[model samples]
Target: MPNITFHTKHIFSALLLFLVFGIQAFSKDIKQCDLLIQNGIDAMWEKDHVKSLELLTEARTLAEKNHWYKQLFLATNNIGANYYNLLDYGEALNYYLESYTIAVKHLEPKYEMIVLNNIAILYSKKKDFEKANEYFKKAYDIAVENKDEVKIGLYAMNLGNVANETNNLKKARDYFNESLPLLKSNPQFEILAKMAIAENDLLQKNYNQAQVTAETLLKTTKDLNYHDIGISLLMILSKSNFEQNNLDLASDYAQKIFARKPNLETKVAVFKLLSDINQKKMHFDLALQFKDSIIKAERELNEINNGRAFENNRVKFEIENYKKEIALNEAQLSNERKIFYSVLAIIIIVVFFVILTLRNLSVKHKQKKLIAERNEQIISLELEKKKSDNLLLEKMISEKETASLLEHEKLKNEIEQKNRKLSAKALYLSGRNELIEETLQSLSKLPEISNNNLLTNHIQTLKSHLKTDAEWDSFITHFEEVNQTFLNNLKTKHPKLNANDIRFITYIYMNLSTKEISSMLNITAEACRKRKERIANRMELSSEIPLYDYLSTL
Candidate 1:
């Protein structure tokens, strides 16, 4: 007993030591993960993108290994930012999407808004204004739903920018106006919104208003040393003055933009404005020089855009491969976990049965004769009990079969009732559509209705509503309840059958006539018959077999 106790104490001590070491190792990994992430962010800020990616990738690996979602989100989002800075928009979008998925699944809505905004910015950079608008609107809606004032202000600023780019000046003004108050705490964003409003005025050809606004912001930018904002204000001032025929002032503002060392896009705009200003001033040589500079800047911009386009397609394929790899890893991990649990359960069950068997074997010798006598009596009782149990089981099974049959019959009746209701609904929709079509035809034949725009629009609206799918959807719901396995069995057997083919097959299954189906589907009877044959051919069924008969068999 002492030896057993000593061995148990040793085992417990080993387990305790292992647990302590495991905890230490886990803490070490967390600390290392955080260190790597912080270092990666520093590298990104320092413009060492390659080093940033390396460190962040290491952190991502560690975070994923330990299921650290927050660290993973940060790492992934920063990786996207790095790619974005490099003009690899496709790769940036891919990582942003990954982080977006992680945020949606494991993090808060605020994180989701961050990734959504990043994705919108990528789309905006790629000149996909429509998609950019969509994502920006989505992020804005989320911010509104969360009542996050900061996010609301930020996203509102973004939406305003998108609206201005798309030439929706009124909408841009509204968004800016909405954001300005909300972003009062954020001076930078407030200035950005004010700048956007100035740009909006310029775009709308309100030259006086634009010049006044830009001049006011120009002083604020100078006072705050906001060089980038100052450059933008200069461009707005240059354009506004040029439009007002203040050529000398425009030239001075454009030249100031050059001194600011603005980005290539801003430089291109400035060069174009300078060229136009020189041309208006009758300085042909100077205009030609500025035009050449514009050409060079535009060529560089095009190269960057083209590079982004190429990377977009390349990264699509890369992301697909990455997804496949992730799926495979998850599958392997799941299989490993299942195997571990299965082995542990088997070990426990085997140990329990072995101990029980050994205990039984140890008692068998002393109780051998008595056990034999008891076994005889037990066998006699078991024989009697088993016979009685068999008889009861037989009776129970008979009763169960009767109950099952009654339940099945009742279920069948219910299904039949649902099918009848579904059929009636389909027929009613068919008749209603037919009636609307007849009314439309009659209306079209009337000269008074055909000549008037209002009447014509009403007729078109009626036609649009005539072929509504809502009733068909309701019918399908009832039909599915009545024939639950039919669609599944049909799909399993005829995998190539499309949705339209399935809908036609469903009508045939419900025993609806061809004319009824045609009216319900807004097609002719001949088309319906052809569709039926086409579906049968797609199913690879023999032409000799009727479609309805084949369906009934299924």
Candidate 2:
């Protein structure tokens, strides 16, 4: 029995190990597949279409096997790009449609927008302008919704080019202008936008404006080595100059277009411009020569057009077959979906009843539990109420104490301010008394004033009034009122300080000069200074710490 149990445990452990290894291997493969898709996209950007197709095909197979819908969509779309670049429109359309279907199935709007733009470009290549415009608009709306500036600029440029082909000059100009700001970071799109603007000006018979725009575009394209745009700009310049009857300038630009060895279309345009210019100048021989060149260029252009038409027809045929296959698949899927919904509906009904039964049982159980919990909560709440009441009472007491302290501080400040004012008035009164005493003494010393008994009597009355201790008592009372705390604190801290010493410190605390203290004290400044020195020595203060500073603290 013990051996059997050990073997069973070992078997279980082996199965678990197998599952873990299997999952790890699967995850590693998924990462490798994703890396291949990324590398494929990078290759496509490098214009290695063959290498891109090989890598993307491998990624697509892996994604399909793993049921990774997102990577599958990306791989399929890049595969389409490879074929599109190779000019295999039929295969490109097939893969693009597959990617579009996957994107829609997965509800991936970003991939959907990308596939829509590719489909529009393919249709435009096929010269199915109406269908191209429809798809472009769809992609444009998605780009706007996503706030994708790059995609918006790309779609706008494509729409403008299409509009220009269809001779909708106003719409073309509007789209070109709209794309310009968004495409400023992309030099290729910027040059294309400028070229479109020049073309639009020429078409509108704004020859001077067209010439200026085209010449500027020509300079930019030449500097950038963008020969395609340069050729287009040269054609525009030739046409503009010829229209304005600048035959010599028109001939020079037309020859420049030919000298660049432009494509058949641009060459044809240049030849036609040269022919017109020569005919306008009545040079029949050169005019005939340019016309013959135009015929040859047109013949070459026709052959190219024929090949494109054949390719378009082939793509159209493939598209029709794909549509038929899609229709059949849709029909099959519709049947399957109907069966699925039927089973789903019956399961939902059973689930609803089961849920309802469980909910009723749950509610009954919960109600009993809730009743006990409510009682417990009521007990807890009562305890909390008591605690809250105590806290509230403490807060109320604290607030009342705070208010009382604030009121006491306010009243103390008011009393201090009144005492200070009274002290100032006492100082003024002391000065007045000194002046009156001085005047009386001066009169007494005068020889003419000695005979004046009335003056002498007045002086005697003033001296009697000034000699009274009432003013001193009043001044001391006021000073004590303001400095009561300082006096108390000083007396408690320094028991040896006498009333006279305290009065001397009070004058110093008031920041009064020695002369002012002498006038207030009816003593000489020297006597006031000696009093301060005596206090400082009594306090044992060092000479480095001034006596006035020490007295001011008290």
Candidate 3:
């Protein structure tokens, strides 16, 4: 399960708004407390509830008890969120209920939705479907009443999650689809909704659609540097690919998942996928390896559980009781034995048992010697093999080093030549820019070019005169192809997404400022902003994330 995080988007926006308005305003009285609260929230996200509770408790105590409603509410919510992160549903329930009481009494609409939604999440996590749906409905109603567009989708998504958990998949799909239209241009929410939809598709046996959805999400999220979502998307795509019988792609994705440095469950899932792949490949040896992996995973879980399940020295008690049972039986037998003949027969039996034991020991000693001799011979051969392997490895390394040096020298010469070529190409680019400027200078100078085909042909002819003629042309063509592919892919994954939206996300992914993107793309700031806004509208990410953030999300 992915860790749920608080959206500090509100805080970030607050800061941005201050800058935009040139508000050299005084900080709020709760500034320290607010920072502490944020810290507590961050701690909770990292699952450090103890620290979160401590910080929240301090903040609550510092506030005016007489007017403690807001402080109490925030504290309770923070502590409850911490417990929720810790998966302590019972405790989390207690704290959230306290927070909910204050929100209801105070009628703080904003805080009310936050608390209610959190409670709903807790209930959902607990699998209390009835209660989960109840809180979700309440929160949704509040969001509607308050016209809180942001909170609305959260409520809907929460409901979708519950519906999914309860096998109300149709309802889940409906909920996700409903959010889709409302969240069209919002990259972050779209990612979440599509992820849910992708999961739903998988459940419905819509492997192809699910695969496309997951792959698109993986590529987008990976570009955005959203590590958490990227892994999830990759995992989903890997499974989808596996289902589609795209074994090689599935194997590649599975291997990436394996190398992802994941937690236990992720590793287990990856191992299972690999096991499946190997089984299909008829690699019985590798398939069996997953059995061992499963065992190891289970053992790790068991080790954690065993601390509470059994007492130390449990086996010793069982062994001692068994000895007592044997002794009691022997005493009873002694009482039943009545004559000298019985004693003589027992002695004869004991003697035979001892002689047989000795004979067996002698035979085992001879077998041991033979086994040791064989092992010694094997060890000697292995040693020779190891020596041969080391020698071969040394030779390979020497050859590799020699080749690397030669390649390095060759690359140095190529770089020197390429630099000169690129210098000439730069002059050509400058000249082309001048030509284009001159062409636009007068309508009569447009030449015979009427459309893209004419312009492309003109460019081809112009390319033949450049210093790095072929290379420049090739690079330009490749860039055009990649750029077109990027646009098409974005549009395909996001049908409503426009060029502005693509540029916005691209900027975010590139971590470029508006000025920087404008400079690079040779556009004005206003034009760039318009493009980003267009992108935002298309991607459905109008707020909570800016164009840059949205693009970064891609």
Quantify all predictions' global Cα lDDT against the true fold. Answer: 0.78, 0.74, 0.64
* lDDT tens digits by residue: candidate 1, 119-192: 99899988898999999998999999999987898898899899999999899888888898998898887888
Q: List ranges where model 1 is wrong by over 4 Å.
A: 222-227, 299-554
TM-scores of all candidate predictions against the true structure: 0.56, 0.50, 0.46
lDDT of 2 by residue, 136-225 (tens): 988888999999997798788888878877889899889988998999888887788778888888888889999998877766564534
Give the lDDT of residue 449 in candidate 2. 79
For candidate 3, the per-residue lDDT at 394 reads 69
Q: How high is the lDDT of residue 254 in model 1?
A: 88
Q: Assess the local accuracy of residue 17 in candidate 3 as a C-alpha lDDT between 0 and 100.
A: 96
Q: Which of the predicted structures, 1 or 3, would earn the higher lDDT when compared with the native?
A: 1
Off by over 4 Å in 2: 34-54, 220-223, 259-261, 284-554
Give stretches of model 3 more than 4 Å off.
1-39, 42-49, 62-64, 127-130, 222-227, 280-282, 301-554
TM-score of 2: 0.50
Best by lDDT: 1
